[model samples]
Target: MNLTSSIRSAFTPQGALRASINLGNPILACRDADGAARGVSVDLATRFAALLGVELELVVVDAAGKSVDVVVSEQADIGFFAIDPLRGEHIAFTAAYVLIEGCYLVRDDSSLRANEEVDAAAHRVVVGKGSAYDLYLTRTLQQARIVRSPTSPTVVDTFIEQGADVAAGVRQQLEADAHRIGGLRLLGERFMVIGQAMGTPKSRGEDAAAFLAQFIEEMKASGFVDEALARHGIEGASVAPAA
Candidate 1:
């Protein structure tokens, strides 16, 4: 895991690697009982720091927009994010390490029985502001009106409070909310599959990006990524297809 001087210099300019860990995506990150961040993304950042032979300084945030903003502003060296065309303008993504589902939730009696039924003009959908689901639906949903909540974890509450026709978010989070509150059912199938990846500011030279891409691919092939998911008891996410 020895890093060349150039790659190290480009990525870890401040000596220690500052990683922006977003806890918004429960499938990727979460806070444990000790209030410490622990999840797939946290594991990846830890391993990444080991590979780079540096100290890991975690810049934790509760929302994805904050994570992206930190990386783009160089407040942190890198962050875990969903690969989206819009984000690529400022960040370079490594090949995805995991695939997470994005699904819709509706009241038990709602007419939206299928994923495709959600895009009708009359239906309003609520999503987390700047989340992968929010960005994807915004681009692809030509008819449905999108109501953005302040954050991903609050989407369910926002949907219930605002009386939005549909709620969109990580399948696991939606399922948890449904179980806690009752009377909500997930749609038949997921509307999107998000590619969870590590991203560095595009301003960091391509050598750093290439190095990270290779590191992720190797981690997948070597079973390290799978081990992390299992260690964290994560489910409904799988190793992404090879780059």
Candidate 2:
């Protein structure tokens, strides 16, 4: 064991190296001045790569249906998004990093301030078609009428433009332009906080899951997750270190 460890230590660089695959979210991902993608996925992935002694290459793709297709086809190594068990056949997921709460945005002047006030027929809820948010509404709020769009940002815009009464969106975009959401108000509390896990091609290997587990553990110890959140201007998160 010691000999094997010595060999690995000698072969590995003091810094991280490159993996067989690396990925980036084409649609939701934002880039910094250095042109590196920057978001929860970006930050976390970078840290994960660092932990594993590998360099993360942000694989860019066209902005359309499930950018994860690149990862699924083995064009990339990892996919940082909400995990779906149905897709488990093509990709293996790491332990979930955080709870993804699907939120609803409404006009502050509207009557949907609370979850109790959600009305299926009265309010038109804009959502991304075939998205996790859509699935949630379809399963949980069977009564709600949702206008399916292609993305969360567009859904929020639908409500802002008076095309819909409500919009389903992630926490970041909802809070990013908080004031410019066109007088919109966050309706109700979180509808659901689905655990989000990262995915890597099943054929690639098990290192994806191994590295993610260790990455999350390190982030928890170093408070990197909280710092990442604040760096993006996000607030009201329940992410204090767990004792």
Tens-digit lDDT string for candidate 2 (100-207): 566777767776668756756666777766566776676667566778776655666656665677787676567654566457677658877756556666765554
Best by lDDT: 1
Question: What TM-score would you give candidate 1 relative to the actual structure?
Answer: 0.98
Question: Candidate 2, which segments miss by more than 4 Å at Cα?
Answer: 1-29, 33-35, 61-65, 116-119, 205-208, 238-243
What residue pairs clash in candidate 1, if any at all? none
User: lDDT (0-100) at residue 36 of candidate 2?
Assistant: 57
How much lDDT does candidate 2 score? 0.58
Give the local distance difference test score of model 1: 0.92
Model 1 Cα shift for residue 88 (angstroms):
0.3
